[model samples]
Target: MFDKIKQKIEKAKGALEHSDERVLASIPETSGLSKKDIYRNRYNHGVNLGGCFILEKWIYESVFDKGGDNEFDAVSSQVNHSSVDEAASKLTKHYNDYISKIDWNWLKNEAGITSFRIPIGYWHVGNGQLLDELPFEPLREVYSRAKPWDILKNLINKAAEYDIGVLIDVHGLPGGANTDMHSGCKNSSPSFFNKSKHIDKMVNVVLPFICRDACVNCENVIGLQVVNEAVFDNSAHGQKSYYSRAVAALNRIDPGLPVVISDGWWPDQWADWLGQTNLAAKVVVDSHVYRCFSAEDKGKDANQIINHLSESISWPRDRIDFVVGEFSCVLDEETWRKTAGNRDEWVRKFGKVQTSNFANVASWGWFFWTLQFQYGDGGEWGLVPMVKKGAIPRRPQGSPTVDENRVKEIINEHIAYWKDKGGDAMEHWRFEDGLRGAIADINAFAQFDNSRIGRWKALAMQRRAQYISRKGDSKYMWEWDQGFQRAIDEFGRY
Candidate 1:
């Protein structure tokens, strides 16, 4: 079925008149939004729904207490102690109960989270058949009966009820992307980069299925994250190559569906690459920033760490759409110990600074590390606890309403300032058009869930291209660009 779908798309690629048309065609006529337009252009206040599908011992220790460290060991231990059928039943219950509708309500109403990053392994794909030749191959029967993919689909659909978007993250790949236990196995060496077969399965089988089924069948699926936290040095070349193929495969199915790639702990290099590459679909660089893990971070006090973060953390705004995919309020014990204030007060200060920086810099906002843990709310690491403790904001401030009269006042001021200094041939009307266009877009998005528009650069680029194509290119196109940007800049002021 996928082969036939791919063949049809390959043929369609040649027949389409313009690259943008392929994207435009995928959008529903009623909504006037491509998946990218709706999902990628919003400031995402999200949380990672971890320890649900991909097992992590630290997040949920009970499952591992009776077994081994990671998902692989847990399943193996279960099958050894009991029967495969018993193991499957136990795992299935965990999947169904880990996250519930009540939790979704809390996320939406209390936390004001608009999106979720759901992490799943490649073995969770298509009843675990895609695990062939991989380490999880022998344990395929366990997941086959558990039907994780089916449960994930149901979760996506449920998220849509509250107008929440989902980023389907293939956290654990065919071969381990990193040595961490979250990569699906314990103490496994990173071999995904060196193995061609591992790359082939992801580019050919896993990603395509995600694009074709999840993005197509699930309305609230915002995007597909190709891999999570790939080792920076080990998979640099291979990761880049894999991303190129993954983008191509996803674009062929739905040109508007955004493809997300991890920064591999090197944001600048990937930002440079994004600037040079001409991608057909939208791409987001997921950079996970954690201050607790590094030695340098451990040495600094809370104030010093906050100052260092504000000064050092930077994203290449002109190049790529980026997000702080994972972050938390937890600081190293050394840093906390060295601080000269109440621990709760410092936690609040740290969380505020991180959220502020992320909102100001990240094209798409941030997602807290994990939503919940098995034992209790994940304290500083959890979104719920942080929000309750007056750390993270319950919801981002709403975009201020900009009426037509208010827009005219700004336009008049702009014309007055430029009148004596500018050429008579200046297209001031272009500026008015651009300003109105931005207002319309913002208004349209708010109707869905009172959400504000984000990724202004990408939105402007798409609008400018369409505007020029429709109105015919002129030397005064810069007027439209300025008008669009000014509205975005001044959106909440009035």
Candidate 2:
């Protein structure tokens, strides 16, 4: 089945290479878009639905009252204390009630969240079959009966009704991506990168299943996160090799679907690597930025931290699309102790700077670390409370409308500047066409959802390909590129 899918992808690539209009048309238009089209075009102002599927004891302590620090121990403790069916029932209840319909309504209507990053485990897929020969195999009966994949599908379909996108984050790999408890186990030592079979299951079996199910069955799924927080030496542990295979397999399943990869706490390294490698047309880097973890961050006062953020948090703009996949408003208590200002005031300042920096640098906007917590309003970590406190903006600043008069003025300025220098040699009309093309795209997205286009680099590349295919190559193509960039900058001004 995998081989056949690869062959089909190759054939499709050949056909697309042979024809330009076919490729252009393949890029979905705004008016009558499929789910994949919606996923591709919109900027994501998202929040993680943490502790729903992938259990985190800190997020909700009551769920772990039975004595377990991680999902593995949680289930193991429950099964030992009670019957397998009862343990399954308790977990199923947690899943069902974690995010209710009312929460969804609030996210879409009031909070203006455009997407959700849903974390799940490898054991969550195939119900029980995926757990075979893995550490989670002992608890297969509980998950198989609970049927998280089915519930996840329902959530995806529900998100679609609200016109929200979902990114299925494989938070927990077969062994464990990192030593963290959130990796679906309580192991002191991580073994996911060390085991070839573990990578195989994820790249071949698990990821392909997710891509097929999402693209075919649940279109609201924006992308499949290959792995979450992979802590390893990139070159030594088959991490890069795993990424190559995962990208290939997913592209074969659905070339339109995007694949997200973690930066392994090394954004600059991966950014350079991605710039050089021909991995995929739509690969994104997910960088989880948190200021509270490091000792340096802990020592800084609120103002100092904010200044550090302004200075330090930046990404190479032209390389690849990267998102602050996870970030929070919380600062360490040590920093809070050093500050003299009111806690609420400092919290607001902290939140504003982080969001501002992320907006300036992140290609697809950002997702707050979490949406909710079990206890007292979740303080800085919760999206709902943070929004209520005016930390994160209610919605992205509204999309800018194209001012035709201003556009005309710019066009006139361009033509007048180049007329004497180029005479007939300069093709100024291409610039006008490119500018108008950008305006049309902006308007199309605005009509669709009052949003600006996200992933602008990838979309620009596609538009360029379409242009070259239609008009053939020319020395004057730079004019079009300049015009497009000008329009983008103009829109940003608004």
Candidate 3:
């Protein structure tokens, strides 16, 4: 069935014009770099630096920190009273306070952190679902804070001023994408797969930012990331179609800015969808890989650790020439485990662990998982915390001290060797080979269905099963088989 689908795609190859014609006409040609650099644009390792406005999401979405005070104030109260919630709240306060004081300019100018990814959720900036119909009065009041245009300009100006490349990611979606990442939608929301609706929001509300002169103010603002981890289910094509529409909208703006796309988060493996993209050379595909949760952590041997990291990343290497948009290597297992779930701790740790073993062979420059959100188990990813409710927090003030000089030294002394001695350099596939095999296994399962719609359905079913099994809802997983079957039947119709 999958082979038939692949054949069908091949047959309609002419009809399926993958490239966006508008984008090709506008973007400036790649100049200055050698042909090799131009070809490997996908390999630029960029980081999402600066402060993100995440606490605002929680404030607006009604995901409060339980205490009427902000998460920070609440934490103070909780800690004083010895309440778990108070401890969490105090942690949140401390984290946000720390980040808000961060020096954004220092990161770029002084530290040489060249790339930064900034996230602005749909709702926080007057573009989210509850924009016109927010329920809570406080939420509605908060939603009225800043318009999208204002935020876009602010981001562009910051990037241009700092001489850092920017990736303006649509961190939130209407009705919400079902993921715990930045977009705070609850788990398994039906809204995740609602393709047409998402496209509408992207076309009308989000795409304009890509075209704005503010965003295109400089080459430093490289691309527009449509959605961050829209991974409720495994609808790769559905994700692609939404991204395609996003690219099409940008192309219309006549800004030859590349569209950065990602594979919805799945643990196993993935194939590249960006290679076949229809756009000019400006398109820079991206992916994020962080696998601290896998059993590979317990393997204990140094060889096992290397094998695990290598296998974990094989998918990104094979699928697209993407930068490791976000990742980290935790040296202490106990500390790392605590950090993964705590946003605040992650940021603190990420700030400290500037030298990584993986940095030497990194496909692209690395963006650590976070800079803020200091309270909670994995809050370490965040540099500081914003006392918000559910999703990732905003970039706080003040820059945490990273061993940037040491980091540069490591990269120059070690990783730079790979760039110079081409033949002697470790092969890209060497690191990513294991994960590639897993994706191949899945792609084989995908090949038979000639219908893209059917393939999407099958993938969604896989996601549902995975979610179900992980959640220990075997009964619901079985019960939902009929529903999944019906979805496949309905989607297969057209």
Candidate number of the best lDDT: 1
Off by over 4 Å in 1: 1-31, 34-37, 396-399, 403-428, 492-494
**Per-residue lDDT over 340-436 for candidate 2, one digit per residue giving the tens place of the 0 to 100 score:** 9689888888888888787666767788989877766678888988988888877754777778899999989998888888746987767776676
- Candidate 1 has an lDDT of 0.78
Candidate 1 local Cα displacement, residue 245, angstroms: 0.3
Model 3: per-residue lDDT, tens digit, 361-457? Answer: 3333456555543334234344223112212222222322224364344334433445666625343221122122222222232231111111222
TM-score of each: 0.88, 0.88, 0.52
Show model 2 residue runs off by greater than 4 Å.
1-35, 232-237, 396-399, 409-431, 475-478, 492-494
Which regions in candidate 3 have their CA more than 4 angstroms from the true location?
1-46, 49-51, 56-100, 126-141, 146-152, 232-235, 265-272, 277-282, 296-303, 315-319, 331-364, 373-494
What overall lDDT, based on C-alpha atoms, would model 3 receive against the true structure? Answer: 0.42
Candidate 2 lDDT at 397 equals 44
lDDT: which is higher, 2 or 3?
2
| Worst ten in a row by lDDT for model 2 | 22-31
TM-score of candidate 3 relative to the true fold? 0.52
